[model samples]
Target: MNKYTIRKMRKSEVEIALNWAAKEGWNPGLNDAQIFYDADPEGFFVGEYEGEIVAVGSAVCYDENYAFCGLYIVAPEHRGKGFGLALTKARLAYCEDRNIGIDGVLENVEVYQSVGYKPYYMNHRFTVLAKRNRAKNPFVREFKESDLQEVLSYDRQCFPAARQHFLRSWIYQENARVLLYFERDLLLGYAVRRKCVEGYKVGPLFADNEEIAKEIFLAIQDDIEGQKIILDVPGNNLPAMNLVKDFAMEEIFATMRMYQRDLPAISHEKIFAITTFELG
Candidate 1:
């Protein structure tokens, strides 16, 4: 076989990587690659065979504690030719024994298991809403570019890796809205949403308290009025579990959000929303 090379991702390669993601039906956030690159500038990678990009992957490493391994893709023509395995190995090698996480396709579990990752959890989407009417929080203002950095920072701590590019675009897109909860000049938490055909959806909502998260959700509803807002909740998180079950929410679909490595234990009590089942 001709020499196939793997190298750290370049800014110019962002389009190709993002294009591949969209082709895979991932429904990735707008400008996902940019924000992802911002968080871990050089974390992604591409594999080339005789100058042709055949595969891509990213090990979005954060310090030595946590990382989210994602964006593993191989061009369709190269599927069974060993590119996918090589790309996966390349990305996973960067994390080694650190606490790494992956939200992967259910069918890929066996293959991932062979690589030393165990299934740690699952995820679900709640879409039904109760009959009562709740108004938006007064402090829940519209999303602004100034809020990008803070949102990214809050998101980074919640996940193993960061996607600064995706966050930047999604937070600022015309169809998306970001609402924040602050306490005494401190950013307590924030939530981001994007317009969807079915309705507006919220993910990556981070807060210090469930009430704060609820306020943010209400604010987002106002921001995108008269639309069905979707919420992705980690099935195992009790607060998220209970809150989703509360008034004005119904079950839609479920998927397993598994992790390869268990990082520092997150406070499930404070985590009422997951960014997304597919992206995070």
Candidate 2:
């Protein structure tokens, strides 16, 4: 039998793990590695077998109270050998004492539950080919650098923790298009559209109502016209579900949002789209 060791991942290895996530059809953002690393530099871990890495996982602690675990993958050749379970256990240990959250793939829900995760809700991924549509909201405009503070303030109401660091990088990522909705100087909502391996994705879409969400969504889609666009919405958000259905987007996949303890207090009503299942 070959020896196996689990150790913290180096910054350079973050990209490798994200690549594996793409291979698994996760469709990770282009600049996800840096933001995730910034969230918890020492949180990602890798399992090595006889000097070759065979598995990876992340337990990124956002604050003392909340942490998210994702990017869990085992090499194709290393499957059925217990590497995945070991890596998961290591990640769980790393996130000890915090309310852990995971966006587990449908098939792996049972596996995660056996390890102490309980399903809170389901998030569905929807994709639509880009089509031009004029946004009628005159108040909608491109995001300005000065709006960062206001955006973060609104974001805090939607997420369980204050992820200022992640928000800074996410909004400024290369080839990203961000937009904000305002009414007479009051920031009503914001949305970000960024290039992904397969196409484009719009996320962290926070809005006060269905009208504002639709306006921001159309604006981003218009900005990135002619590319595929994807969004992940909570199954419980009826307005978000109706918006996707109105655009005729197809449901590509789904994940169960699991937590180790009681769910965190987040304003899901205003969360039109989740930032990233991998990090949140």
**Best candidate, lDDT-wise?**
2
Q: Candidate 1 residues 1-280, lDDT tens each? A: 3578888889788778878877875555564666666657667889998889999887877667667777788898888887777778888888777677777667778888887778867677777531223664566666666776777777766765566666665676666667788666677888877755356567777777777877777666653445567787876777677777664588766655666656346655556677655346
TM-score between model 2 and native: 0.96
Root-mean-square deviation of Cα positions for candidate 1 versus the true structure, in angstroms: 4.2
TM-scores, all models, native as reference: 0.75, 0.96
| Tens digit of per-residue lDDT, candidate 2, span 1-280 | 2499999999999999999989988999888888788778989999999999899988988888898998888999999898899889889898888999999988989999999999988999999988777646688899899999999999999888888888898998898889999998999999988888989989989899998999889888875678899999988789999889989999989999999998888788888889888887
- Evaluated with TM-score, which candidate comes out highest? 2
Error of 1 at 128 (Å): 7.8
**Residue 223's C-alpha lDDT in candidate 1?**
38
